[model samples]
Target: MIKIALVHHINFNHLSLSFKQRTDYIEKYLEKILDAIIVKTNISICTEDLLLLKVWNPKVYRRLINHPKVNFLFSTHNHAIPLIYPETFTEQMLLGSKVILDLINPKKIQGVGYPSEVDFPPKISFESICKVWEGIILGESRIKISGLEKDEFSPVFTINDAWSKNKIRGHLSRRAFNYRDYLHKYFRDEANSGEMLLGIQDDYKKYAQGSVLLARIDLEVILFNAPIVDGIQQEPPINKFRDLQKYLINHNVDFLKVADLDKTDYKIPEYRISDIAPCSSENIKWNNKSLKRRVENIKFDRSNKLKYGIWLSLQCSDYYCTNFQDLCFSYGDKNKKTIFITKTRIYRDQESGIKLKLLQGKTLDQIKMNDNELEKYMQYFMKSNELLTNYL
Candidate 1:
């Protein structure tokens, strides 16, 4: 079987807006994405959390929960963020996972990536992430084995209708064995079962606003490759995922949930990740290099007091408004920043009520969570425990 997986990277957008505004924005784009996925029959997708699903749209929630192919994977930001406080993060994920288990009804939740692909520091360390997820998780899809973010790093954005092999190494599949990152030797023995799990940072705002994407740029415009809106972008037509699903269907590609990675009966022909993970062009070198350098700088940047290498980029607007602005600015080179994406977001410490607790040198499990604290935290993140109240 030609096995392939698609990860719709779900994250709450317009975070800087009011609670209602955030919910509205998320709901609008979310339904658009869901419309694309749900329209086709038997199309399975792996996604971050269901907090938004449970909060905004009960009809979609019912359809998704009742849908046989839905798989809910944790972004592992504890399903929350904006701190070193395990209390905040843990409460969020613990609660989000609870809702997901009750709704999406996946057999297992083993994968963990960052929400919005932002790895904030002191708050989430690689060790901390592993520890936080170990007890709750079964496997991590791609844990720095390779950055699963190519749609953004690529200077151009495509609907990704087909899989083509390119010569780019590490960043994209250069050879026939082209899964971004996975400890596949431990799991699979087959060689070429298409691409492993392909992740698209699924956000309407990102595509609409031109941050995570910049489409239609000529190679000659290297100096003018505007990551922050200097290049042309392919605005997703309605039902954007249809062509992708149609292509896979026409090619006889079978969709696989991430949970399948843990079981036996691996099905690739020879490639470790996938024989068909498509690679971007040489144009990606400049943009991809900048991101890699940023990762390196963040690795040793002692300025944050927290460990570096937490997969951070000041290119995100969250940096500009957060306390980390100065640090990120210093860490980011003028020429080396990825797309500068920022939106007014409701940051954690900036809120009031239920004094937020900060976890200093603590494991995630050490903190005990209570309903009151979780409820308070949920209000800020999702507004009044909507995941719990609205879902049930």
Candidate 2:
């Protein structure tokens, strides 16, 4: 039996359900999936406990390194070394600017402000620039520009109805530093290809901030280090469809939207330069056209009742920590503060951990004497977690 160790982001506890509830739910799911595989193979199957970690907490890793069964670590947050973030830029280079062209955009240049530079089609328009700028701030990479094309290699981009020059400009840049350092060794063969890294654009490029450039360099390390695991692959190769499936299967990880996968999976570049037209201004104007729709289509033929509701912690806090803040609100009472406490536990200073001044006097143990108090607390907590699902 393959021993699998699942690593969770710190955000897991911050999810809607109580820590016990979430763990129980995941435990059952893992058993079911493995049970099927075992029945078919008729082999003894053993499962290791899933190891959850606070991705941002250095202490967690310190403990993780000591775990005996720990192997195949995965993360939703940035932790790989060499931070991977996004960068977006407006112009390829300034006059006489010292340029380090990715092989794909290999044009020898002396410095940032040189006027003798060869001119090509306006590589970026003002509208596109603005879009990418917004994308950088939002940590979302959604636009790209086409660069030199090659007949031997299949075009890396395709046109989509949702394309918008303005939206394209709003794209963000992703820098995955850990992956970059690891991937570069394998990419050395192509070191001389003179091919611009398929796509490398960042709004951060405009600022020339050392931090942003460092992020870009880290991203290159990620690209260079990516280990296309034999069968593991990112799907849709676009909107994170594949990444979500992988996380769901391996991590028992919870996510509400496909976009959330961006938070769950290891880094993947966000720019799609080959499909510049969809992100162009003219196309962005017709975002709803038959050819350019961006949002997914949903069908509602049946009644909608949520089975689970998701709760998001507006701020980060640790369990039983006095400094924690209660971010969720109680129903019918804007001023009333609430903290989600499971019915099984009783505490005097529940509010002391994650104080919600509004919930100043409320306590699950104190409220337990009230009729239906547990259900009320669970439902309210579930609503905040956004875990309730509705099926018609």
Candidate 3:
């Protein structure tokens, strides 16, 4: 009875692809999912980059033009906005996406998704962003794979491990998936008990051009077949959606849209930045030392505003994102240069909306950089083990 949802992060390709091949990747890979949207039960396409599809496949783009069942929402630009950039940069990315989304169908689109689901800072979110943009915050699980203890999985929203959960089928054997046993050990204990947003994320084109993607998201399941991890075998993904759909025909795993929430007894929770575990700018490199880090908290002054001007080197994730051990809010001090950071509590801010400003530009870069303030804030993945493997 777990309420599940599937999300596809599209247009994100391998770093070394040629311009022409990039479009081909989508046509060859994403087109299969697009075709499924029409033949299978209805599937909603919420992306951070619609222009990726607009430029890559016009046929699929037209399908979403006015199709009510197949929806469109622009998430922020590809990067994890909140964790890496300043509040101003986050605002710019949101506005840029909003502008492009409006052009597609202003009336149809009214929500936005977070880039990597990074928790928003209290100072920025509670006071300004949500009230200004006035759009719904359409997002998923707040549980970072870097979760320290089994307890970390308790979030108002959820991350549905579709294939991992439906293992009785012919997908991965129970043995192979034990590496992912935390999915059950931590995430599933209360997955079915409440009204929460359930989601699954795509690893930057984990489903490639030649790969198989049976996007049965209407059943809240989107699947990508194997050939992942470079050296791994070419295993086939599960066709569990259809089977699950039939099972859910009379069950209680309700697939409710955001607008319909008010009719139910859903409660909105408030959060302070202190609610989240203190996150380090370090890449996740811990797990063996102990589970003690799971419950550690860092102190942050609500009154101390974020000090901008820190620049992460191009492709510098070494600076921020996952990892819970050695939690420190800022490095150095008033005497030395410091890097500011925050972690979001898993349950709060599930569907909160924010107001925003618009800037003019044909390309996203031009629009984002238009703000002199964002350039200074520049600089933040979804790899869980990458975080939990070493003592970070």
Candidate 4:
């Protein structure tokens, strides 16, 4: 049976001013996309973008939340940043998972979608985060597995070196297999019942078409990239949707939701995690050396705690502003230093509202603001502006 699970990574960051001055453009596009999916094929779209949509337009959000075809997936609350860093663990687990669950509420969400293609962390870190999700956040909600694909990571164009490319590819493949094995082993008692589903993105037209085949696993789902309209132009081309619709119809492909995977008898091809070849020791040593050099280059100040918080709040802006205060409360004084360092890595050279290089060796005290002024800034930073408007 030719089966494909169509998925999209919903990122609120994409809806910034670049998309349009008004919000209706996004809402109209969302409705149109979902409507097309409903009419053209029997497929269910799996996405984590609904939460932000809920804030933006309640009517559209209701349509999706109540829709029989949409499958909600867990993701970090803020789409701009990676969920891999140690500082983001609490935000990913507590804030990210909770918001998704609370929105889904009585309806069970089936899978977890990584925020970005570049967001892959260590396999162990991924497992640790998923465990918390399985135990705490996913109450009565059964997720088969998380999805990752080469195309998602394709945006990282800096891996020009052959050795780096080989190492990354090997690492990703091993991680995919490892995740599959972990899911099966972790839920062995329910072996006959249900297994975690890992949806890897594979486009038939792409050179990496044989990824699923290479892994010796069946293609359970194939997701088409949805266009994120930027007011100026349409992405993925509007015609691509019609083409996909025709492709699915021509192939006589059976559409499936994440929940359906659990109910059916379909099983992921069994594979041992250890059997997957590891990256060479040379690659490992090079990576360590590179990381050490990067760490040594970034200078951090330990004295001013609030300055870091203010800087982070400003950098994160509306994306994660609300969580900053609580995050501060959660961490101890000593841990703030570590948090600041992690923040530097995550944000790096990303531009912020303040127009200053946030990661460049500037401490909280260096800003020339008094304690009371800093406290006032904290209060302002804690408040989040309207992220989405109800245009519908």
Candidate 5:
């Protein structure tokens, strides 16, 4: 049985939805895509056979691509950035995963590796949008994977005839997989049969613009499949966990930690977490480096504090929240700091019974969060003395 890993970034483009609403839409939409699988292949893919993960950084995403246990790697991001490849762990697993890299616009480029030859389609449809994703699996398994053989350069394209007869930008299978066989199998079945489950990011619309939506979708795909309980759990930013809880409940899915999933049967359990989680490459490296150098870096200090809402960036526009700038720059005045808390989002910290809360509730408009808010959130960091290790 091949295990598919659908990694995606989250972005809110289609709907004027809240974090919870947006997640519901994406999870359902992606689930529909997975349900469409059997139409293209006879393979029976269970929700348990697929894993979802959310990566905050490109480094973690890149590593997931090379993970051996990941039979197939699908990313919905726009630009492909190079980062720390989790090559070691994947190689050790030796799962022979296939990699899928998605490009929003393929016709505009000359070729897969070079410039394109065709003009960009005037109007792209969701049904025919060009998403360049690669996969690393065996020949038979290749057909089971949708668009597995499709690349940026292909003679035949799959466009919605109802909408337009426009050609798809990506190429069809070029190597081990035969295009004829793939098509025969794909068209032979009118409908697909499989358990469908959608994965979405509960708090994504607030932070994403249309330009970055695709990148966010890439992370969302990963998170949707990732087992969350064993995923990286950092301190101070309890809002993340709160958001995660909301995601599970809103989707009508049960939540289980990574440890729990490992013990459960292969049959799809309500929900499961992954033992090997992905993290930001830069953040992990910064944490791994020596502490002395981190303190010397002012930017790292600010970022560390920003994570907890203690300090804000001077580079931040004035239109955003100004609290962080005021408090961090206050120099020695401790009285200038104020505790800002969220009333709605409250989660019990398993490690500490103390309730974790969001610092700000207002939707983050084009304007950024107040600097003061950052300073207020960092109180936990300052008290714990763990901020020093977060520096570069």
Candidate 6:
């Protein structure tokens, strides 16, 4: 049977509505959607919306929590950033798991909805994070389940050129394959005695439909992104819902809760980057002179190889330069007068650059040059940046 897991990520905190309006929206649209299928199908619903629901509408929260057809998974407290970025793996898991534990009892917490759809590189730290999460939820047991969104590799292909399209697909396919391989290698036991079911998102949408089918993934966690609303803004409009229902029924799809897979023993074979024959960076031509100069100018501290390498890469990459600046602003030491000093001087340089930018009227909208505003901005900036650079 073709199994499909229906999952919804309700981020109430980020919803563009007031408390009463949100509650009303949920009742009018969300409830109706559930009412239509709750009895006919099994669904897994997760939310970062519980904090608001618990405080403003306890009755609704209780009803959903107790619903027989609904299986609630724990998404992070706020689904704003990727859990892998700003914090250590252990810290992210603890914070996210704690939110779920606080809302519902530990027994009810079956799995987690990783906050973002970003494809994380295969790092040992990621594996360690998964182990820690297993300990917290399963406790002395080895079985664990993680549901990751699948839109990362193939969100859409808008390129008109056939060659470009093929190139993009090739790159994405390798990344997806490597990620799946990484999970099998790092999470499963060598003896094939443990179960670590990884569910990849496969929303019943056109963009990811092809990739999802190609992957032949074990679990398909379908997402419903549009919020239910009145006056025709509601998602999965009546016609679309009917089409989806027909598609599933025609395909002999089994609608089930994602948590139900924990009962099954599934093993994914080990695959690695080498298996895909990935293109080496050495082959790519370095045409960007500015980037080359930036990398060449940044001197690395051999004492801390990992930190130095990361810093150097961040300095060279446009996508990460701002991130590097934010990191130094938040964590870089300012006490040059201290008796004992650290070897890293790049952070101080980064701080100076930021100050220069501020003086040149290039401050971020949230920050100002004034003393009061600067202090508040720094405090807020540190917290926000830590959310992304926490692991570093």
User: Is candidate 3 or 4 superior in TM-score?
Assistant: 4
Q: Candidate 4 on 1-392: residue-level lDDT in tens?
A: 33443344443333122223124333555555555454212211212234335555668777766666665545554432332143553344344555555667445475443332223333334444544332111100111122223333211111112322222111121233322342223222222111222222233223123222111111111111221222222232234444444544554444554233223233323222222222222221112233324333445452444333323222232233211121111122432211110112222122232213334545334544333532333223332222211110
What would the per-residue lDDT of candidate 1 be over residues 221-244, giving only the tens digit for each residue? Answer: 111111222333222233323444
Give the alpha carbon lDDT tens digit for every residue of 1-392 in model 2. 01111111222332233434333323332222222221101110000011122222224333433332222111111111001111111222110011112111222211111110001113343343333222111111223344322212111112222345343212122333222332242232222112212111222232212121111121112111222233231111111212323433443222121111223222333344344422232222111121111111222222322211111111112222232233332222342322232322122123112222213333344443232433333334434223212111
In model 6, what are the clashing residue pairs, if there are any?
85-388, 86-387, 86-388, 86-389, 86-390
| Residue 172 in model 1: lDDT | 17
Locate the minimum summed-lDDT window of 10 residues in model 2.
Answer: 39-48
Regions more than 4 Å wrong, model 4: 15-27, 39-52, 80-84, 105-108, 113-115, 123-127, 132-243, 258-351, 354-392
Cα-based lDDT for every prediction:
0.31, 0.23, 0.29, 0.33, 0.22, 0.33
**Candidate with more favorable, higher lDDT: 2 or 4:** 4
lDDT of 6 by residue, 95-156 (tens): 45565656565555555334322223123334444432331111101111121223432322
RMSD, every candidate, angstroms: 16.5, 22.8, 18.2, 17.3, 21.9, 18.7
TM-score of every candidate? 0.40, 0.19, 0.44, 0.44, 0.19, 0.40
TM-score of 4: 0.44
Indicate whether candidate 1 or candidate 5 has the larger lDDT: 1
Model 5 stretches with alpha carbons more than 4 Å out:
1-20, 26-29, 40-392
Model 1 scores a C-alpha lDDT of: 0.31
